[model samples]
Target chain A: MRSSVIIFPGSNCDRDMDVALKKFGFKNQMVWHNDQSIPKSDLIVLPGGFSYGDYLRCGSIASKSKIIKSVIDFANSGGLVLGICNGFQILTETGLLNGILQQNKFLNFICSNVYVKVKDKQNKYFKDLKKDLLELHIAHNEGNYFCSDDELKSLEDNSQIAVTYCGVDGTENEKTNPNGAIKNIAGIFNKNKNILGMMPHPERMIDKYLSGEDGSLFFKNILDNFK
Target chain B: MKIKVIVTLKNGVLDPQGKAIQQTLNGMNFGNVEDVRQGKYFEIEVKEKDEKKAKSLVDDMCKKLLANLVIEDYKIV
Candidate 1:
């Protein structure tokens, strides 16, 4: 499989995502944010980092970058696009995903390992995965997720919610809510499930020695599902 | 013509920064502060001679790029 990782200015995690994708047997290419076209690939990633210095709201400016038009077109045609951390913020800003990732409710940046419960396995991103709960790394100040009540209802009704923050034992509640995301939503899928936007950084957790191996499972699952 | 605009979080949206500022003021003995909400202001200079046209262009800017309609409201002044 092949993948492309879009690199925006200040995208600190672009190389990490490229590494993770390659480690999972994907031939990966790095695409610059200024490029108007992407090489044909099975997956495209918007990696984590403070794009455009998080100016005019996190991911807001980068969402309007030249490359974003192509990205939006790719997603609208059912292409698989994954937005992690700042990438998730960009996806919401682009109107490809529901809701906005507001600043942390407590007004602080949070960097820690978090347990995320896979809410649905019907999508290619998490389908047929063995683990129900994955340990992932989350680092961000604007990770709190908020949406209109009506949109939330539609998401729940359609099972568009992909993963949610949860306890290690898979229990979800206020204590498990790290950044005050609504309903503990750590990630979500578009109505078609081809696009996923989430706050956690699976690329940071791909190695057991450095962190943990659950992220390995995440990457492998997508590759397997594609095949 | 210069167009002025303010973007604010809609009612019921959480404003953590505003809350923090309010708390700090209260701690400084400004107990009369009932509530506080943070917002952004922008001034755009448009070349149009007509005030209505300048304001209209700014209104489009607010809707398209200056504010996210989902979480913020923008007013042109």
Candidate 2:
């Protein structure tokens, strides 16, 4: 499948994403953030990193980059966009996705692999995967996601709440909730429901036994519906 | 005229950095801290002397790039 990843000046995960995509058997193009166009692809990923040195706020400045206009247009056209870590923040800042990403409630940088339970499998991204539980690595200092009460209710009511932080035993992990998200949400999808933005790095856990390959299926689920 | 631009998080918005600083200061025994919120400042010296035009430029800069406007609010003083 054709794939592309956007790279901003401070993006440190660009290479990691490229390697992950390659390991997934897809050779993808790395699109620069300044380009005012989205390269044709089945998937577009905004990888994790401190874009624009996290100036002003996490993912705030990068949202106004030249290429964001195109990304917004792309998402409006029903295109698939996945924002990981800072990418998730950027998406929110750009208003391509709902809510705002604030700093972790703990006032510290969390670098541990996090467990995420799939809250919704009715969508193509996780349609085949059982909605029981899954695991992915989350590395971020500003991963706390917040939205207005009404908007939070709408997100839940529509099953757009894709993933939440949970212990390996299938219970919510309060300490690891990190940012005290409204409902331990680690990832979410837009109203259009096609675009997804998540803080956990599925790309970091796609290898079998190594990362248990639990996250690889997330990609396969996408490939299944796309190609 | 020199104008000070103050950018701050909106009400009810979480400010982790601000909270951290507040705790640090309080821990050092600095009392009388009511509330704390983080903000940014931009001291711009502009060539345009017309208040209307300078104000318009600053607004445009904030709207087009300087500010996210989604979660941040900025004012020129």
Top candidate, metric lDDT: 1
lDDT of 2 by residue, B1-77 (tens): 45558888888887777888888888888877757899989887777879888888888877755665656788987
Query: What's candidate 2's DockQ score?
Result: 0.54
Off by over 4 Å in 2: B63-70
lDDT of 2: 0.82
A161-203: candidate 1 lDDT, tens digit per residue = 9999999999999999998999999999999999999999999
What lDDT does candidate 2 reach at residue B28? 82
| Candidate 1 chain A weakest ten by summed lDDT | A36-45
Error (Å) of candidate 1 at residue A75 is 0.6
Task: In angstroms, give how far residue B34 of model 2 lies from its true place.
Answer: 2.6
**Model 2, A82-111: lDDT tens per residue?**
899989998988888889777788877888
Native contact recovery (fnat) for each candidate is 0.85, 0.54
| Docking quality class, candidate 2 | medium
